[model samples]
Target: MSKGFSKEFLWGGAIAANQSEGAWDEDGKGMSVADVIKFHSKIYVKDYKKQMEITSQQIEEAIKDKSEKKYPKRRGIDFYHKYKEDLALFAEMGFKTLRVSIAWSRIFPTGEEEKPNEKGLEFYEELFTEMKRLKIEPIVTLSHYEMPLELSVKYNGWEDRKIINLFVKYSKTCFKRYKNLVKYWLTFNEIDSIERHPFITAGIIPEQCKNIKQSIYQAFHHQFIASALVTQECHKIIPESQVGCMLTKLTTYPNTCNPEDVEKTLIKNLLNYFPADVQVFGEYPVIIQNMLEKENIIIKKESGDEDILKNNTVDFVSFSYYMSLTESANENSEKTAGNTIFGVKNPYLPSTEWGWQIDPKGLKISLLELYDRYKKPLIIVENGMGAVDKVETDGKIHDDYRKEYFKKHFEQMKEAIEMGVELFGYTSWAPIDIISAGTSQMSKRYGFIYVDQDDYGNGTLKRIKKDSFYWYKKVIESNGEDLE
Candidate 1:
């Protein structure tokens, strides 16, 4: 009934290297910020205040604790060793693209290194070549919630202006090395999340800072300059390539029709949109600037920072949409949490096993709002439900709920295109199950292909295709024409 997806629309899945690759210290790989993060119970997921305050003492203790059981991210699903088989499975699923992040510590070892580790570069080279051979285009994220642990411990993350150059060095090496194999690049994963989880997002240990707010904003400034600088270098190295900024598209709905509630919702949405607005429009929105001033936060900027941001804006905008948040003006309102965001509960919507509210229409709203705001090509880089999957006696998984979730979201995506949104691609959160980002558990699965692993890091590490795997294969094979 409507004009369908474009001929070259990218359809695939995405996984961060630190979340999927196990060999945390193999082949010259150094410890990343992700490696030292411990696996907390479900109760800690919503205690953002405590999580954000990661101290140096905690880091020292985590480094000494030689238990993979406590630190599941230290040993990811071993994608460092099993990428070939995984890519083969993705290719069999008719994936047109695969979104992956290059571990910064793998290449730089430490943020101060002048030369990259040749072994680290060699590994990604082999990985990308195989993807190219299978005709699978690679969309790479330069920094995806993982930076050198040494950076945070020694330099206090991106707060120091010198981190700009360090990040640029890492970016230049990647741009020059993998220019042939990858064309699409994202500067940062969820650049807006630094305030929520400073350690994971920007390698900042909040407990070390006297004024965390000031440090956070200063880091944001450095990252903005770094993103712009890398974007400029990416163009110089790969003339035909495209670069984008990724954000957590936090959609908010007013709890009621009251004008005050609507105003509160507007302000809440701006908090999440601030970073993306800078990357896409090349300047901070006036409201955000005013908010910073009110908070007494002064961001130290270099001489040409304005010029760099203005001259080199992103080519497209990518985002991860998992849930919609409800907002109310009432101070004492019922609240809930979802994948790095908090909001009031919407009674009409259901939640996943992990408490992330499911709102398929929210994806449509995000696409429409983003298109209207930026007028640039949009890509949904991550969107999937995490659930505790059970295998029947026959060794086959029947995950109809997961299938329904994607089907509804895919329908909304198609409707968005019909309404004149210029979408470039859609890569689901993960093609294969990896360690959970929040809880660091392998049991919280969100993949068409399941990895045989558990919370205690025990299993054969075998790959089994769920029923949704076959269903998604047909969807990709038909170019989103078939849903059932």
Candidate 2:
């Protein structure tokens, strides 16, 4: 049998409202950047068609680069309307907690509203109430890259200092409304990735903001301030609640055992953790400040920004560990394709159909490293494999591969906990398959319960249990003992 977890171990599923909830325009909700992008196939196919217009031979080259998401996935999996049913399913899976985001636009309607939207506020009130009815705790993210589109157009997104205050107002509103329902709060989802890929994540192109460095620095600064302010607000409003930060943990591996390669890998790994360290630890890493100065990018520290971070330090460090990468200064090294800008292939690990490296051990290492550096409880907010599935004649999906994927990761996670890592919990990327973030397609399924939807967006929105569903249920029921 697997090693049993602590008595307080939390098991649950995670999803963002924008990623799962379709009613983008319903209940006075405002539009987000996710509303514009099409699915992965449409993007790749269109690119392919364009390349072929230049030369027929370019088809091969275009196809190589065309991964997925030709268009934004259909207004998500309709979770806005189906959250009741979805939550029921999660309850069936024995979810002790459900990690979801409150759509920022839903509350503010416009990013800079002095008054909050009552309808948006009421919707989440009902949502959290339902979770409480089901005895499932809610782990809520204040901002999950769903910045109001109006904010982007008017003030260039987070570039202006005004956003810091606006974000705090929005966060405070939620805290007061749902203080009893949600004990776990996160300032932002994957803020580091948003800082890294502002255009894709938030539609704020760096070129439009004076310069690339200025745009990124400004975005990071605004988010850090927002986080700090939100943490402070949460304490005053919900003093007993635990607040933390979410990062997309893209772990790095050395290209080789050589000393130079190992040194480079160490530096690359530090880059991933540096963003969280600055926010959670309240001081920017020496290496990060050195690099910023070398690049001549001065980060303007607002009055009290340092105090905000220091006094409002996060209670935990939560991260999404998807896969690991290997980096080299060598220009000709093979490039790995995935969601993040820093993503690269690890020569030692196998890759998914989408070219994402699969290394369960990397998850263990990432957990240990974060705990070692931060000395705070670590919550794995997201981790899973996205792959293609085939439905057999019996109308069942025998996804043994996904089960194996979770098995290996759980084994390593158990080891990490044994190593003295204060792990809070582990939640799969999505309990139910929704839209793929990078490609914006539903075909790249990652859910235990598969929704019968396709690339063209046809089907009954039916939820079918994959083989992994039963496997995961047992894993939860036994609290990891079934894994062994």
Candidate 3:
């Protein structure tokens, strides 16, 4: 008997290998695009584009530079070797599920490998086994931001279409290896983010493409095919498994009642839903196709590509909702930072230190809107606040702000659930702070468990529980009824 959720409600946290696992090149792992994305200091906070884009020359330089200090993701709090200890802490918190992504390069090293990396397969097997031992369900994402750098360099990543077969190969290997261990699979982490950061997400460097938008859409088409193919394989390999599509849900509103602002906001939201529509409905939305045609961006699909997508729709829709955006037609309107895009400031809302607006009510709105449209079981796979935390002299990290963030969002989630949204689960963006995906800084902490590491990659790699850790543990024990 829970307050609002079903008895089997999933409550836990999420992390990606590229952000948490060090050992970047260990156990026959090759470089990923994430390895080449250099970490800039706080000066580049507003210039996130500079952090995500990597040129061929820069990749060559990164290959020559062996220092992990320059690229912080290369040494991500050492989760690669310390997952046992970390999982124990999660188990202590009564985590029902933990969402993690499998690094593609770790399994294939290069995308062209004839045989899968045995060591990488063994690592995840042991990981899933440990989670089972701890009574924690695993929700695994096949591809996060980390794609094999070799594929990016040789085939320009997904744009060449050959990478589709390669990704399918990698995915099949994972499915067969972990068939009995993992039951929940997400095809891609934030699949919609390809347009915002193409180089990192899809491995498409702008310099290599004659038409950037065309290449972006072309690469995305390939991913849609790959995702469908993998979903088909996942179903065949594991009958009880549930596969989903991940989106970075940037819910937007008009700044005013002006038709211009409302119309632009409507267009922006429609474009945002195009990726999920293909995954859920098994076909490209008409609006997205028309928009592509008007932009002169052609997606060259294979003969049965449509059939593959149409036949293999996702069983669930999972998304990350960190904040909301407000659109305005006036160019001089106040603007603020967000996950990957900027939007006009909402005077009614407050923002994080990174200028991402905090809007718990928007989460409810997003849930209602997505459910009404897709009519699918929805899971919020990622949601959490990134703030500057302090470790008191007593060695305790008091993160009441983090607790309050989750508290408000949980209240709204309960409201949405009670309002007839088929909401299922929630996995916080991270239970432990790893590396900032945008700026590659560790200072932007989002974890209930804090790592001793700093932005420059210094510290003992120790984990300390924050005040929110106990708060969240209670929330889970009481099943959404004990926020107090």
Candidate 4:
């Protein structure tokens, strides 16, 4: 039998600042790219192209908009006000690590600033202090789904080379301030999503750029450099700190046994892994370089760019693994939607309410593949199913489905460990239900502890424990042995 979770394995949950902290403009916080994203209906949720496209007109309108309800991210579950209560709940569940992101806009309201907002820095200091008090190790992600809105409108986001220095400045400040508090840092959350949702990932508006593909890849290059620079700075400031690259691990499989389908699947999987390859391996893969040349996408690099990446490679690999996908060469293949990615449907796998294919085995496959490829410690930062949760009159939630989902995934994780994967940690997608990142809806819940909120941002904002909460608590207490 495979060994259970290691004694030092990080058992916790993950949440982003933009998706959870609501005080949009309070206490010197500036607007982030996520602030402008309005909640669309379910009909438009899966329409990735339409949902991601942002125009100058939309930007102008969103800037002047004053309705927080329309933009649910503007007023998240108010984690700003209720973090103490939330952290207590997490502590009750015996959380060892909690993955949280710091909004760049909060520190540097505008992308370019001489000094960070003191109030913003102070806020994080208090939060991190609290986490330390609770003995819950804080794993920080410097950037999640958003950067400052000012950068997008004025500098055209990461497409501008100047943004690279600004990001490095912000990261240096973080490393210096939280040197003792935070030891594990991730440069960006799902760095691969820059191609999937440019607006959300890098604040790049497609219409604003002259060459869309070139601009996107150029922006990606800047981020890659930024991540490396930050990793380097973390080493200088906090020698013991470990910095890792974050990727959206969208594992893909062949849709059929056909050779064409198999070839297409291989390419698709490589494309998804390309970004991480650069981050962890410290060089762009040959396949990606060939794609850039074929597509005529030229990335302008300044002096030391190549050396920066080559020298400051991440210490570990962290990723968000919500679902897997399949690819087919056939034009008429059936399709499904996932977390900002879609692929042909797999006949053998079941899907969640959000259309994300639920293949527990995929987790094992992804771990083995990533470990084999990178030979580094890996952490599952985000993995959970979002469902429309219901509450009983007695104030109880019987979410056997959610419990089973984690149980199966945990079993697969054990299998991978037995197979010799150097797994570091497992922080579930969310310990508390926060606003959905892609859809920006609260109803699409993925928390063991439910938050009383709705799609329109109206609720008592009460946090309630679900049945899975107890299940997870036992799993953690027993170190993954007492799943039943």
Candidate 5:
């Protein structure tokens, strides 16, 4: 293994508002698109060509039709009400930082409101204060796939340029209110994924925009402007704090040693980086622009968007690297049944029940590549293995698989650090397992401390420390060397 990380390395857990905090309708919180989407009961199989063919209008029309049966409400775990206890559990795990997001609707209620909601602001204030009391730094995502339903309905979400100004207003409020406590901020979580899954991310069905690529590009345009503008605002308001953008780093590997496979891998890498590179590097990659122009989908730009992105790049790059994908030109080749954009298979790797490929080495590759390209300190905002844990009759979950998964990943991270990747921290996803994002169930667990719950939503709302919990605490305490 490579040399261990710096002694001052931060170790913690990452979660989002919509996923863990299940007060979907409380304290004036507006409904988000997540509230309406059905959970995936079975593993999501990817048909790459079919997924590629799906347009924004097609998705939007399906949403508008509303003939689909409704799923159960995701009001389980109730982190809104249980954060105090939950945070205490996090503190027990020796967390140096706690990554979470503030719900947009909770803070703004209406996207364009002149005055913010005091109660909404107060909820986060108390949450942050609790973290501060425990000496845990707050890593805040300004927006995490949770937008006010009102915004999507009235302003067409990020497709409308007006939302940029409103987003800035909300971000500024977060800066001013939590400036003292929040030292790290992310403008948006997985901005690229949101563009890819707009109906799921922002609730602005693609039908509203008439064109998928145009809608996605337009939505991304506004998000880029907002992220850049918010970075500038945070600097102005909180000079000491660092602001960044978070992306879902679904790393890709070549299907074979063949040059064609390598070339396909490179193309997929470029496609993954398209949204973020444009936001951080200020100009669109020539290939993507050429493709858009060929397709006649021009992203309309406002006056100062380019200048904003050019002048205000994020201070750091953060991402969640759960798994990797292997790419090939042959579409019919057997692939892992994963929930990735390029749903190709990795011949050499095993996969989780959910179809995500298990690839700890990909983490090291991702860190090296991102650091080389951006020349900025990297923060791994989320990395964890999601699995079904069997609770023993004694009420303890061994979870050795989780322990082994993280151990290998941490070892590789040590290698990346020695290779000169300036890593700021590593925060595993779901320090305490909450609801699963894709399945909207607690069964697809990814936490060190497993909460007693299941797909049918029946179990004591009990929190038990899985064996991995103690295992990770030791690793963190030793600065990533103590793994047994």
Candidate 6:
């Protein structure tokens, strides 16, 4: 047997609102950036630029098109109505906590409204109350790729700096409203992904910008200030709250021992850590500042931006570790996509069908490094594989592949905890199948409980427990002791 996890260690699952909640226009909800994105066929899912590139024209057309047939997110497994049943299923799995995001547009509609939407507020109150009854803690993310579309159109998302105050208002309303329901808050989901999917992450339309990188970095600066301000307000509203910064931890390695490859890996790693470094350390890394200067990208800051950031550093760090990436200096090296990045593939590693390489050891490395650097309590907010599961004739779904995936990662996590890393929790990316955030494909599922839905949004919308569901219930019952 392994050293095992602490009794207080949290074991649970996570889901984002925009990916699971399907009432896009119902109950005073407004259009979010996620609502305008269309689903691509499985064959074309790997075309990153085509899949994510959003234009103002596309937004206009999407607004006019009322059908959710093309846009899968608009019909996200109908979680808006089925949440009670979903939460009960999670409780049955012995979930100690559940990480979920609030749809910003649901509360503020166009994000400029003076009054909060009562219907939107009511929905979450009911949801959280259910979790409390089930003895589950809540880790709430304020924004998770679900920004109001009006802000993106009028102010170009975070580029114009006006979004800072607007976001603060929205966050303030949430804190005042849900103070008792939520004890843990996250400012953003994958805060480092602003550049990967610009419109989806930060609502920046590339066609409106003269220089994409400048606008992206300017938006990044605004987000930093906004995050700091939110952190400050969360502490004031709920003194016992533990606010955190979230990142997509893409641990990179040198393809070989060559000095050139090592240097390339180092640069990649630095950029990967830059976003979290700013949040955790309360200042920009000197190297990143120098790089920004060389690029002639100047961030226009307000008077007290530095003080706000320094005074309101995160209480803890949370991140998603999907897989590890390999770096090489050779431009001709074989490239494969992994967690929103294209990198040289590691031959020693096995990759999922989506080309995400499996690297369980990378989780241990990430935990140790993050704990050593910040010395802050850490939590794994998102980590799981997406795959196609087969339902047998008897209506049982046997997903042994996913079970094996989690087993290997859990063992490595045990090793990390034994080595004295201060990890407090582990929440899988999703406990039940939701719409795929990257491609909107229902077939590429990651869930212990299976949702009956197809890629084009056609199914009975039934819920079936996969074999991993029972296995996970046992693991949580044993406190991460029963890997078999």
Q: Which candidate is the best by lDDT?
A: 3
In model 4, state the lDDT of residue 356.
85
Please provide, for model 1 over 118-203, each residue's C-alpha lDDT reduced to its tens digit, 9 standing for 90 to 100.
Answer: 99999999999999999999999999989999998888898888888999999999999998999999999999999888889988
- In model 1, the number of clashes is 1
Candidate 4 lDDT by residue in tens digits, 316-340: 9998888888888897888888888
Model 2 ranges off by over 4 Å: 1-4, 42-74, 200-203, 342-344
Q: Would you list the C-alpha lDDT of every candidate in the order shown?
A: 0.91, 0.79, 0.92, 0.91, 0.79, 0.91
Residue clash pairs of candidate 6: none
Model 3 lDDT per residue over 1-484, tens place: 2249888999999999999998998999989988987776662334656666778999999999988988999999899899999999999999999999999999999888899989999999999999999999999999999999999998888899999899999999999999999999999889889898998899998899999889999989999999999999999999999999999999999999999999999999998898999999999998878988998888898789989999999999999999998999999998888887788999999889888899999999999999999999999999999999998999999888899999999999999999999988999988999998988889999999999999898899999999999999999999999997
For candidate 5, the per-residue lDDT at 73 reads 34
Give candidate 6's TM-score: 0.98
TM-score of 3: 0.98
- State which candidate, 3 or 5, has the greater TM-score: 3
Pick out the ten consecutive residues of candidate 5 with the lowest summed lDDT: 65-74
Per-residue lDDT of 1-484 in model 6, one digit per residue for the tens? 3266998999999999999999999999999999998887652324766677898999999999999998889999898999999999999999999999999999999999999899999998888888989999999999999999999988889788889899999999999988998999999899889888788889999999999999988988899999999999999999999999998998999999999999999988898889899999999999999998999988888798899889989999999998998999898888887876678899999989888899999999999989998899999999999999988999999999999999999999999999988889999988999998988889989999899999988889999999999999999999998989
How far residue 210's Cα lies from its native spot in candidate 2, in Å, is 2.0
Cand. 1 Cα-lDDT = 0.91
lDDT of each residue in 1-484, candidate 5, tens digit only: 3366887788999888887777766777766655565545654465432332334444345346433223323464678888999999889889999999888888877676788888889999999999999988899998887787667767667888888888898999989998888989998888778655775554556657778678887788788888888989999999998988777887888887889989988887887888778766877789988978999989898677778889988888898898888888777877665433546877777878778888989899999989988888899998887888988999899999999899899988988998888997989988888776655666788998887766666677688999998998888788888878
The local distance difference test score of model 5 is 0.79
lDDT of 5 at 274: 81
Instruction: Judge candidate 2 against the unseen true structure and give its global Cα lDDT, from 0 to 1.
Output: 0.79
List TM-scores for all candidates, in order: 0.98, 0.92, 0.98, 0.98, 0.93, 0.98
